[model samples]
Target chain A: MSEVAVSIEHVSKKFRLYHERNQSIKSAVMRGRRSVHEDFWALKDVGFEVPVGSTFGLIGSNGSGKSTLLKCLAKIYYPETGSITYNGKIAALLEVGSGFHPELSGRENIFLNGSILGMSKKEITAKFDEIVDFSGVEKFIDQPVKNYSSGMYVRLGFSVAINVNPDILVVDEVLAVGDTEFQAKCAQKFRDFKNQGRTVILVSHSMTSVREMCDSAAWLSHGELVKVGPADETIDAYLDSLPGASAA
Target chain B: MRYLKEVLASRELLANLTLREIRGQYKRTIFGQLWSLVNPLASMLVYTLVFAFILRVEPEAGDPSGLDIFAVWLLCGLLPFAFFSNVVQQGMGSILGNVGLVQKVYFARIVLPLSKVGSVGYNWLFEMGVLVVVLVIFGAFVWPWLPLVVVTMVLLAIFAAGIALMLAVANVHFRDTQYFVSIIMQIWMYLTPIIYPISLVAVQSDKYGGLFGTSVTILDVYRINPLERFVAVFRQLLYDNRWPDPQDFLLCAIWALAAFTVGLWIFRRSEKGLAEAL
Candidate 1:
C-alpha cells in the first residue's frame, strides 16, 4: 500500500538458445525441426520492490540475473510470468554508449542519444554545454565517437546519463570503466541523486562501493533472491557464503 | 486514428532522428550530406547510359509534347522507386541499429522506422527538385497536377512507412529478414513495372490469347497493384499533365491506410522480443 517507484512480483525471464539462431526461410522451415535449443532461465520467480525515493542495490555474480532484473524494470524484457510495474521517468546507464553511433561526432551523438532517451531537443540543448564540459572531452566533442578511446567513450556516455535527471536511474557496473577521479565523481553524483529524493538502482561487484553507497541491498544467486536487507549485513552474508572464503 | 495522431504528435522526434540518420551516415566522410543527392544521381546516370545507348531503348510512348519528354516520365518513376527502396532497406536495419536505444529507453519504438521513412522521403523530395531542373533543361516547363502529385507522394510515404515498420520489427527477431527482403524487392521491381509501361502487359495478354479463354488485360492487373495506383497518379499528374484521377487516388489511400494499420499491429506484437533477440 505504500508509495512505490517500482514493484516486481514473481517475474521470470527465459531465453532459448538455438543451435544457430537461424532466421532464414530455409533455416526457419528446414533447420527449425532439426535445431537443438536449451531453455535458459535468466530469472526465476524473482520478486522485489523499491519504495518511492529509495535506493535499491542488486548484488550477484555474473549470470545471476541482476542485469536481467534491471532490464525487466526498464521494460526491455517482458517477464514470462507475473508482472512488473514502474512509475516515473527512467534512465539506464547499463552499458557505455548504449545508443551511441560510432560514426557520429560526440556532439551529434548527444542529440541522438538524448532523443532516444526521451529528452526533448530543448532539454538536450539546454544542458548541451554542461554535458560536454562534464565529459572532459570538449576538444573532441566534434570528432566522431568512433575515434574515442574506451575511457573517453565511457566519460561521454556517463556525462549524458548524469545530466538527464530521471526519476529512476539504473547503473550497471559502468562506474568501473573510468579512472579513479571520474569514479569518485560518479559516486558523488549518486549521493547527490539520493539527496534529491530520486530512486537509484546500482548493480556492482565492488562490495566496498555497495556498502558505502547503498542503504539496502539484495543478493541474487543462481537467479534466486538469497537475501535482502541492510547493505553491510547483506554483503557480509554474501561474502561468508562464497565457496573459497573459509579456505582463504 | 489514435495511433496516427500519436505518430504525428511525435513528429519532432521523427524529424530529429531522421536528420540523425542522414548525418550519422556521412559523419566522417568529406561529402557528408551531399551523398544523399549523389547516390540517386549516380543510379540515374547508370540507367540513362545503359538504356539510352547500350540497349537503344526508349519510353514506349516516345515523348509527351509538353511533358519534358522521357526524362519526366523516367524521373517520376525513378525518384519514387528510390524513395521506397531506401525506406525498406534502411528501415530493416533501424531497430537492429538502434538496439541500444530500444533496449535502454522507453520512447515509442515506431520512431525508429518512421524516421527512416521520413528521411528517405525527404531525400526523395530533393531528388524530385533536381528532376524538375533537368526537365527544364530539356525545355519541358509544364506545371504538374500539383494536388495529385502531393497526394501520391503522401500515399507512397505511408505505404513505405507501413512496410518499413513491419520489416524493421521483424528483422530484429529474425536476422534473415534482409535476405528475404532483398530477393522479394528484386522480383517486386520487375513485377511493378518501374522501367516499363503497364501497356506492355496488355499486348502480352492479347498475344497469349488470355488466361483460359477469359480475357485478362495487363492494364487491369496493373491497376490492382497498390504501387501502380500511386505510380499511375504520379505519372498522370507529372508527365501526362493531367489532374489526378480521383478514383485512383482514393483507392491508393485506402490501401495505404490498411497497410499502415496492419504494419503497426505487427510491429507492436513483435517489439517485446527485440531486445532479447538482439
Candidate 2:
C-alpha cells in the first residue's frame, strides 16, 4: 500500500471577484449597464505529497496561496482541476472564529466546533472536561464566548481543535494568537503526534518554526509550487530567493 | 446519493448546528426563546386590528369554517404562510451567514441550509403552542384534529427547504438573492389566498369566463401553486375542523418531493464551486 498520507496532483482553484457585489436593491437594479464580475484563479496547478507520520510545512508569501492550499487539503476549498487523495480521517483548524456561535458558552462551543470537524457527540462527551481543562478556561467555560478575551477565545478554539484524534491533521497559522506557554504546549503536541506515526500538515510564514518542526516542506509563490523536499533545504532556497533576506 | 450519505454521516453535526442556530437566536434576549411565540403573536395582533377591524373586509362565508372572527380565519392562512416564508427567507441566507464554518470545515454542505430549516421548525413548534391557546380562547379548538398540523408542517418545511437550499447557493454568488426574495415573497403572499379566500379567485374566474379562453376555473389554476394547496389544508383542518381531501395530500407530496430532489441537485452541482466562490 502507498504510505502517502496526502497526495495532490495538479490541483487548481478559481474565485469570482465582483466589481459591485450589488447587496442592495438599488444597486442590483442599476447594475443592468454591464457585467460586474471577474474570475481570478487562486491556485494554478499546484501539487505536493505528505508521507505518513511526517510533519509537512507549507510556506509562502501572503498571496502565494499557502492557506488556499491548506484549505484544499482540509476539503474546505474543492480543487477546480486535478485531484487530492487522503489515506485517513482528517481534521483541520483553518482559522480563528471557525464559526463558534459567539452567543454559545465556551462549553457549548467545544461540542459545536468539535462536531463541525466531524467528531461524534459521544466522542466529544467522552473528552469534554479534558478539553476545557487543556484550554485553562475552566472557570469561564460556562460563560458565553463573546465575553472572553481574544486570547481566551483563541485558546479555547485551539484547545478544542487540537483535542481531535484524527489520523491526519491540518493546521493553519492559528497558533500565532497563542501565548508562549500554549505555543510550547502545541509544539509538544506536534512531537507527540510525530511519535505516534500520524501525519501533520502545517502552514506557516515563519521559516524558523517550519525548519524546527517539519521533516519536509513545500514552498509556494503566487499559487504555484516553487520547491518541495527536505525542510531545512527548502527553507534555505526559499529565503535565498527572497528580495532582502538573501542579500542580508 | 452522495449528499444523503454525507448528511447521514454528519447527522450529529447537523443536530449540533441546528441547536446552535436555535439557541443563538434567543441567547442574549431577556425573553429568550419565548420570543418565538411573542414574535408571531405581535404580528398577528397588528394585522388583526388593521385588517379585521378597520377595513371590515367581508371574509368568504357559507364555508364550513366555524369561526366568523376575521382574525381567526385570517390566521389559518397567515400562520402557514408565515411558516413557509420564515423558512425560505432564513434558509436562503444560511450559506452566506455560515461562511465561517463553510470555508473551514469538511462535511455535508446540505446541512447548512437544512440546519436553518431545523431551527425554524423549532420556532414553529412554539408558535403552534401559542396557536392552540388562541384557538381555545376563541372556542374554535378541535382537539382531535390538532395533531394534523404536524403533518402539514412537515410537508411545508420540506418544500421550503428545497427552495432555501437553491437560494442559499445562489446568494453566495449573487449577494442579492435574499433581497430579491423579500420582494417576491410579498407578491407571492397576495397570490396565495392568505388575505383573501380561494373562493374569491373562484368567483372572479367565473366572472371572467375562464382565463386563456379555456373552461378551466381560476381556482384550479391557482391550486397549481403549491402554497395554495398547503394553506388550503391548514384552513380545512384547523379553521373548519374538517378533513382535507386525501388526494390533496398527494399534490403536497409531489411538490415536496420535487422541491427536495431539485434543490439537492442544484446544491450538489454548485457544491464544488462554493468554497472558491465564497
Candidate 3:
C-alpha cells in the first residue's frame, strides 16, 4: 500500500457569523453591539486520509463542509481541533482570481501568483512559456487581466495553478469552469498527475466526474462526514441519502 | 518570534507583492512610474509657493543653516513626512484591500502591511533622487553625508512599519482606524514643524516658555515627537550638511524599535483570525 500523503484527524473549523457590517468602530458604537456575531463550526469532527498517488474526491451538498474540509487540507483555514499533516508541498486552487490583480498583465500575474504559491522567480521563468501556451491567451498576455474575458481569466488561473507542479493538489469546484476543451484538458491533466505519482483531492458537486476520476471519496452532509470508501460505493451511498433519490 | 521568522522566510513573497503594488500604483495612468516623481515634486511646488513665497520667513541673525530658502528646508521635512504618512495609511488599509488573498490564501499576514510600506519605498527612492538633483542644481550639495541619508530613510521605514503593523491589525477590526489614522497624520504634520522651522518652537517656547506654570519649555515636549527627531536626522544628513547628533539617532532608533515591538505584538496577537476579522 502507498504511504498516506495527507492524514486529517478529527478536524473542525469554526467561523463567526456577523449580523452586519460592524467591523468599523463607528458602527460598533452606533449599534451598541460589542460582540455582534455568533460562532459556527464549518466543519465538525471530520476525518479522512488521502493516500500517495491517489485521486480522492470530497463530495458533499451545499453548506455540507466540502470546501471547508478542502481548505483545511490546503492549510488556508486552521481547524479548531485535531490536525492535518501533509507529506509534500501542496498547491491549492480554492478560487479563481483571488490573488490576481486586475490592473496587472497576465504575464505579471503569473509571476505574482507563482511567487505567492511558493515558486521562485527563476522557476516561473522556466515554466513561463508553458503556462502561457497552456492558458492559450498569448494574444492578450501583455494586456492587463481586466481586459480578459471571464472565460480566459478562469482558464489562465487554472493553467498557472496546475503548472506550479504541486505534490498534493487540492482543487475546489472552480475547475468546473472554462469550456469543454479546457475541461477535457483538465481531465487529461488529472490522468497525468496520477501517472506521476502525485496526489489530488478534488471537491466537486459533479458526481459523474467524481465517480470516474476518484479512486476513493468522502461524502459530507451538514458539516459531518457520512461515508468514506471506494468512489462508487460512497457516491452511491451519498445519492441514496438524498431526499430526491428515493422518489426516483 | 515565530512570526518574525515566517515573515523572513517569505521574503520572496514580500518582494513580489511590493513589486505588484508598485506596478499597480501606476497601471492605468499614462505617466506610469513617472507619477512617483510628479507627486512629491508637485507637492513641493505648492508648499514652496505657500511656505516659501507666501509666508517668506526671513533668515535670522543666528540662523543655524545659512541657506534661508524655505523650499529646500521644507522639502527636506515634507518629503520624509509624506513618506511616513503614506506608509502608515497604506499599511493600515493593506489587509482590507487584499482581502481577496487574505481570505483565500495562507501566508504570513505581516507581509501585507510590510509590503505596503516597502512599495512606498520605490516611490520614495525616486523622489529622493529628484531631491538630490534639485539640491545639486541649486548649488547646495551635501556630498559626504549623502549616503547617510539612506540610513535615515531606512530608520523612518522601520518606525513607520511598526506603527503600520499595529494600525493594519486594528483596522482589520475597527475599520475606522484607517480614517482616524489619516486625520492624526494630518494634525501630526502641522505639529511636527515641517512647514515652519524647528527654531520656531524654540522661539515660541522661550516667549511663553511656561505653560500651565511649569518651568519646562513647550519645545521640550514638542521635541518628544519622535518624527521631529527623524526629520532632524534627515536635515542634519543633507540640509545642514553635517552628521547628526548621536542623540537624534538614539531617539529615532528607540522609537523605531519600540513601535516595531509593540506593533509586532498586536499583529501577532491578531494574526490567527485575520481572515475572519476582515
Candidate 4:
C-alpha cells in the first residue's frame, strides 16, 4: 500500500510461563532463584502492513496469538524481536471500562477513562455530550458506576474509546458487547470512521463479520502468519483449512 | 529524561487521576471527608494518653514560642510522619491495585504512584491547616515560620514518594513486600521519636558515652534515620516557631532529591515489564 497506517515487520513476542506462580521474596531466596519459567513465543516473525483508511481484520483460532499481536499494536506489550511503526495517534479498546473506578460517578469516569485513553481535558470536554448521548446514559450520569448494569458500563466505555478520534483504532473482541441496537449504532460509527479515512484494525472470531466488514485480513495460526490477502479469500482459506470444512 | 518529558506532557491525566483518588476515598461513608480530620485527632488522643499521661514521657516546652502543650507538640511531628506513611503505603500499592488498568491501557505508569502522593498530599495540607489554626489559638506565633513549614512538608513528601515508587515495583514481583513494609513502618514510627522526644536519646547517650562502647554515640545513629531529621525540622519550625538547624534542613533536602531520582529510575526501568508481570 502507498499510504500505510501501520507497518509491522518481523515482530516476535515471548512470554514466560512460570512453573510456579512464586510471587514472594522468601520463596525466591529459599529456592536460590527467582522462579522456574519456560519461554513461550506468542508471536513469531509475524509481519503485515495496514493501509490508511482501510478496515483490517485478524482471524485466527483460540490461542493463535491474535490478542497478543493486537496488544503489541496498542503499545501495551513490546515485541521481543521486531518493531511496530505507526503514523499519528493510536487508541486501543482492549477491554471496555478497564480503567473505570467503580465508586466514581459515570460523569467522572468519562473524564478519567477518556484521559487514560490519551484524550486531553479540552478534547474530552468537547466530546463529553456526544459520548454520554451515544451511550444513552445521560440520565444516570451523576450516579456512581457501581450501580450501572454491565451493559451500560460497557456501552459507556466503548463510546469513550470510539470518540477518542485517533488516526488508528485497535479493537479486540469488544465489538460483540452491548445489545443489538447498540451494536447497530456501533456499526454505523465504524462506517463513519471508515468514511473519514481512518485506519481500523480488529480481531474477531466471527468469519462472517470479518468477511462483511473488513477490506483486507490476516490469518494467524500458532504464532505464525498463515496468509494475508483480500478478506473474502483469506477467510475462505482459513475456513477450508479447518478439519471438517467442505470445499465450496 | 524522555520518560520524564512524557510524564510532564500527560500532567492533565495525572490531575484527573488524583481527583479520582481524593473523591473516591471518602465515597459511601456516613461522615465522608470529615473522617480525614477525625482520624488524626483520634490518633493524637490515643498517643497522648499512652505516652504523655500514663507513661510520664515529658517533652520540653517549645523554645521561643513557649508552646508547652504536649498535644500540639505531638501533632507537629505526628502529622508529617502520618502523611509520609500514608503516601508510602498508598503509593506502594497503586500499581498492584490498578492491575486491570495497567494491563489494558497505555500511559505513563509513574502517574499511578505520583497521583497517590498528590492525593495524600492534598489531605496533608488540610490536616496541617487545622494544626496551624490550633497552634495560633494556643498562643504560638507560627505566622512567620509558616512558609518554612510548607517547604519542609514538600521535602518529606518527595522522600516518601521515592520510597513508595521503589516498593511499588518490588511489590509487583513479590506480593509480600506490602506486609513486610507495614511491619517496618510500625517499628520506624517509634524509632523516629514521633511520640517521644529526641532529648531522651540525647540524655541517655551522654550518660552512656556511646552505643555498645563504640565511638558512635546512640544519638549519632538515631539521627541517621531520615524521618528523625524530618520530624526534628517540623518540630523546630511549627512547634518552636524558629528556623530549623541548617544541618537538618540540608539532610532533608538531600534525602528528598536522592529518593525521588532513584525511585523514578527504578519505576521507568520496570514500567514495560509491569503489565506482563501482573
Instruction: Please list the C-alpha lDDT of all candidates, in the order they appear.
Output: 0.78, 0.83, 0.85, 0.93
- Per-model TM values vs. the true structure: 0.91, 0.93, 0.94, 0.98
lDDT of 4 by residue, B1-278 (tens): 78778999889999999999999999889988778999889999999999999998899999999989889999999999999999999999999999999999999999999999999999999999999999999999999999998899899989999999999999999999999999999999999999999999899989879667689998998899999999999999999998899999999999999999999899989999999999
lDDT, candidate 3, at B91: 92
lDDT of 3 by residue, A1-248 (tens): 57999999998899888778676787888888766678898888988888999999999889998888877776667789989999998888888656898999999999888888778888899999999888899999999999999999988888888888989998888768789998899899989999999999999988899989999999988899899989999999888888898752
Model 3 TM-score on a 0 to 1 scale:
0.94
The TM-score of candidate 3's chain A against the true chain A comes to 0.92
Error of 1 at A109 (Å): 1.8
Candidate 2 — which residues are off by over 4 angstroms? A15-41, A246-248, B58-65, B137-141
Tell me chain A's TM-score in each of the predictions.
Answer: 0.91, 0.90, 0.92, 0.97
Top candidate when judged by lDDT against the true structure:
4
- Model 3: per-residue Cα lDDT over B1-278, one tens digit each: 76668778889889989998988888778888888877777887898888678887642321233455667777888899999999999999989998888877777878889998889987898888887787667666567778788877888999999999999888888877977888999999989978777887798899996879988789989999999999888877667677788999989989999999999999988787787666
Interface RMSD of candidate 1, in Å, is: 2.4
iRMS value of model 4?
A: 1.0
TM-score of chain B of 3: 0.94
In candidate 4, how many Å is residue B238 off?
0.4
Clashing pairs in 3: none
Interface RMSD of each: 2.4, 2.5, 1.7, 1.0
**Which segments of candidate 4 are over 4 A away from where they belong?**
B211-214
lDDT of 4 at B246: 100
Model 2, span A104-163: residue lDDT tens: 999889999888877888989998987888788999988999999988999888888888
Better of 1 and 2 by DockQ: 2
Cα error, residue B151 of model 2, in Å, equals 1.5
Cα displacement (Å) at residue B66, model 1: 2.8
Docking class of 2: medium
